[model samples]
Target: MQIFRQKHLEAVYRRAAEMGPDVARSVELQMLITPKAMGIFKPGIEVIAPVLSTSRKEAKEAVRFIDDSPIRHLASITTPLIPMRTSHMSLVANVTHFPPDVRWCTDNIWIDAPVNNVLPGLKHIADTMPPAPNHSLRLNWQPAASRPDMAFSLESNNYLAVYGAWTRPKYDHKYENWAT
Candidate 1:
């Protein structure tokens, strides 16, 4: 169990490094030092969750105070509004990292395993993050006219007349039967 926890923690740090410095620090401080660090020792909920922060100072301090600094060099990098990559298949959503921006791509992403043993060449590419806001949440726009035409409406020659024909005539008693 101890060995496994160590391994999982390492992997989490490795993934943070891949996301870029600010992202890595944010993750380490918010998720690693706060929740996952305790989870490693507690029963259940041993998986690491995503790191989230509205402020940069708290993120920096939390990471700095943590016992083990997996990727301390990441603090020197600048932060961007968007994530480095649009598609980080190696990252998993909400599990490995947080605020939905740092997604967890790999399995067992919650465990605190060292990235060296878990991910291939993760250390080499730790700083090679693609970009921020890796994903776009654009609303799907479709022209109203593009909708498929209704078959019933298209087949009817005189829909308006047919609708009125269903009604009975007021004055003609003989035409009552014709209405039916």
Candidate 2:
């Protein structure tokens, strides 16, 4: 029992020692990107969550004291805004590293996943994602009018293979009806 207690205490001490250096490094990195350091007066929520400050010093200190960074370096430094469709949006996105419990409504989605381990990839996820029973979002696939023929033959056996599909209405689970 004493040995177990000592082992736990040693582990806790080791972790605390490790965290001190890491936190200092994080604070130093924060200093580099601070509004005062960058001479940025404009309200930019891109780095840290926007805090209203009268002076640069306050902004710097506020930034240095930030305990967590849900927003990553990718969205902050370069290509500040990469616009997406209005229907879906997520601020804190680590697509590769999803939360333990990531649930997707699939009333509209006809395909049932065999198991959780054999889940869909980014491309397959769209097919599995549920659309509204009434309002089914569709991406019409018509070749560009300007460049109808760049170099490829527009001949295919499948309708969807050549031309994009018009989305059908989703299924309503509550009503047990296919909404139009």
Candidate 3:
């Protein structure tokens, strides 16, 4: 899988580190797959996972799980599926107290396909395999920052609901919906 550190965001990380131990401790190592890698070219389907939260060892285990799963194969029927890649190593701030509470996120793997085509496979995987080791690593299915919609978190059992929400039409926002 392709992996790259976002050199541009390094200053944010460094600033958080300088905020003392509390703020530093709040930083989490996250992994996000690109929309293109997931075969999603649309605006609303990006997904993100906080895979490497606590340590590098945990990150390796999470990476191995993703690499071996059917998740990497959720592309179109005609096109060959692309392998999962590390979009970036995001320093996500878990606490709101921090000034730059950066939340690095993306779309669902099956965003390009119809919900009917995608949900069954995800449901089967969720049923047969164990829940994500760390419950916190669940997928965040959300629209792009430009859209006016609420972001939903998908737990192991709630995969159906998350997929169902995607079928809804986008709505106009009265206020700014700014969780990117």
User: What are the TM-scores, per candidate, against the unseen true structure?
Assistant: 0.20, 0.17, 0.25
Candidates 2 and 3 compared: the better one by TM-score is 3
Worst ten-residue run, lDDT, model 1? 156-165
Q: Which 10-residue span in candidate 3 carries the lowest summed lDDT?
A: 158-167
- The local distance difference test score of each candidate is 0.28, 0.25, 0.27
Give candidate 2 regions above 4 Å deviation.
1-47, 66-180
Decreasing lDDT order of the candidates: 1, 3, 2
Q: Give lDDT for model 3.
A: 0.27
RMSD of each: 27.0, 23.4, 17.4
Tell me model 2's lDDT, rounded to 2 decimals. Answer: 0.25
Clashing pairs for predicted structure model 2, backbone only:
none
Ranking by TM-score: 3, 1, 2
What is residue 112's positional error in candidate 1, in angstroms? Answer: 4.4
Report the number of the highest-TM-score candidate: 3
RMSD of 2: 23.4
- For model 2, residues 136-165, the per-residue Cα lDDT tens digits are 221112222354655754522111111111
- lDDT (C-alpha) at residue 47 in model 2: 22
Q: After superposition, how far is residue 30 of candidate 3 from its true place, in Å?
A: 12
